[model samples]
Target: MTTPPQPPERYTQLKAVGLLIGGISSFQIGATLAKGLFPLFGPSGMVGLRVCLAALILLTIWRPLPGQLNKKTLMLLLPYGLSIAVMNFCFYIALVRLPLGIVVALEFTGPLTLALTGSRRVLDLCWASFVILGLYLLLRPESAAHGNLHSLDPVGIAAALLSGCGWIVYILTGTRIGRTLPAGLATTLGMSTAGIILLPCLIPTLPLIATHPWQGGAALSVAVLSSAVPYILDMMAMRRLKPRDLGILLSMEPMLGAISGLLFLGENLSSARWVGVLCIVTASAGNVLTSPRNTHH
Candidate 1:
């Protein structure tokens, strides 16, 4: 009973797919680039620069009105923004101490767990088991020849896990805010609030820009690649792709992070960690394929 897409429509859909992949690549690239600035700016400083610059760019584009900030909206935006701050702050901290791929793989558990929350289905239990096995493999101690898991900083692991918690909050609050406000406006304001919260960290890094102007440019690139481009491309992709299809494509993010880390940062994962990443990736994709159609985007 359903009509197939026309050729032109199919072409557009293909382009959307490409854009989505590109957005994912851009985000990973941005993270790699951000890591390079750690020596000069440190994780907090780099995150502050990236978030504040991204907020400025988004504000310029969306330019949401002051009247939109009603008390009700503010309540939603505050928690959403705080989540962004916490997520990025902890993420960068983890990134400083852990390999980019490993950090991303660990951080992804937040959203994966969120997706599985309240589900009683047997298949969902399988997916949750995959996550647990992956975590066990990733965190368990190993011999030196196999790349000792104990070499990974406990603080870094904790930060990555905490970042996942922040991400859970980000998703919950952002969803509610999206229902009440335009997506662009909500994102802009939330990012702005995060920037304001991160201002203290940005302060110390500002003076360094004069001595290392290139790092400033790199920070801006991080803002554009990580935030603005991905957001814009995702908006376009969502319009053309089914929610499930989009989710499936996005489930490749951890793999993309690993690839980006290897290619750009010269980082390599151990065999056990590689298996851990695969398990998580499989669980993520499986969740997407099996998720109820009526679930919130």
Candidate 2:
């Protein structure tokens, strides 16, 4: 006979869920802080500080030697780090022109698509349709609140979509390392790789942050909330969650981002935008609720 989950295993799964929630919350908080820094450092400069300082902080903790990783492992890990660096650069740039919530909503498309791509269940398709419709309403040219859809910066929209693609790579590679190493230590190495990729971009921001202590302080905050807290927690959760379920769990991102934008950044969304958020919430939540027991990692 198959054994049922012991209390310990059940507790562990619950902890994983909590970590996922915490990670997502911290990530949005970090994004909000990063948004506020844009004026002082500009997008590229602020991203540079966030990525580089975060690398330094993580490295301080783990102090990984280069020789520890074989050539094959380095090959896999490098892409993950590079994706994170480029994604942050592109995302902050998109933030320059877009509302935080909208950017996050748009970025979800990549993962949502990935999650629903091969599902054979009718219920799954229903949620998939909701995602499609929600995105359409978000992008529709006419708005009930304003009588016209808010104009979007084409470049910003493109960058946000690109950010979604970056996240896919991040998830794939992060899952591999999460399975093989201590989450915290693996993150340090990953952040070091990201730091290397972002170093050239940081050159111009050094003087700006040095002169403006507030900007430097903000960078530190980003490192903690964005990279340290969320990345570590996510790695922990990934160790116990399926990638599809994890993708679905991340669907909460749009709602978290929208609320964060409204409260922290004074950004408002149209009715259609709100609907889009709701659809994603439903689809993602339903994905988790209705998923098979086997889907749970």
Candidate 3:
């Protein structure tokens, strides 16, 4: 009888996991840097600067040829760029007003919702229930014993919700366009488009650098850490892992963000908020564990 075929290499699985963790960690650190810079540039200025600098860095690296892509590709990329722009803008707005942990937890809902939307699995319903519990804990009004809810700004909450919507759009667009283009090229062009769209906003703020060099420096740091570094790492990671594995790895971002915010920004959450975090984390982890190993896409 013919010998059986050998099993796949274990090293590949290990390497993929490592890449995913590295990507998520890079993103968390980037968010922490952005939060630190918020006081200087405000949300809009910081996001604009981040996109512009990221576009420059990625363009240098990818050097995607102009006019090479067809109209079909451009049509797909338009919403992708818009989603990225809006996601960054709203996330910064929330970051400026809320604790980092809270903002991240809120944003986690976006991808979680996307994952559960079309699934008919019973386990998916379980995940949905936990997510609902987490949201309730995060958004519920504080009781007298818990003190005031004044720290939770309504406008900031709204902005965070909008950010979640943008993230959903990003996920959908990624599913469509990511397959057709290389990750590096797609990311570079998408960010470049966003930067160009925001150019008008930057014109007014560019003069502030002369009078406020410190603010300019802060903005530069945010651009480097939040946009360029994370984007590059994410592109690298995407090459190693399947989409489901990547999603599972990204679930760790909120926890990493919470830790970074605690260490660097002195941001803290209440006991209830911690519970909410646990709920969301459990839901994500459970989904990943239950998913099949053969499910590549």
Q: Lowest-scoring 10 consecutive residues by lDDT in candidate 1?
A: 142-151
Q: What local lDDT score does residue 266 receive in model 1, on the 0 to 100 scale?
A: 97
Candidate 1 at 238: error in angstroms? Answer: 1.3
What is the alpha-carbon RMSD of candidate 2 to the true structure? 3.7
Global lDDT of each candidate: 0.91, 0.82, 0.78
Weakest 10 consecutive residues of candidate 2 by summed lDDT: 141-150
Each prediction's TM-score versus the true structure: 0.95, 0.86, 0.88
The candidate 3 region of ten consecutive residues with least summed lDDT is 3-12
Relative to the true structure, candidate 1 reaches a TM of: 0.95
For every candidate in turn, the CA RMSD to the true structure comes to 2.4, 3.7, 3.3
Residues 1-297, candidate 1: write the lDDT tens digits. 977769889898899999999999999999999999999999999999999999999999999887878899998988999999999999999999988888888999999999999999999999999999988878776677746435688999999999999999999999999999988899999999999999999999989988899889999999999999999898889888988878888888888998899999999887898899889999999998987852555
State the lDDT of candidate 2 residue by residue for 49-144, as single tens digits.
888998888887788776777776777788878888868888998888888888888887766676677899999999899988877766666544
Which residue segments of model 3 deviate by more than 4 Å? 1-16, 143-151, 292-294
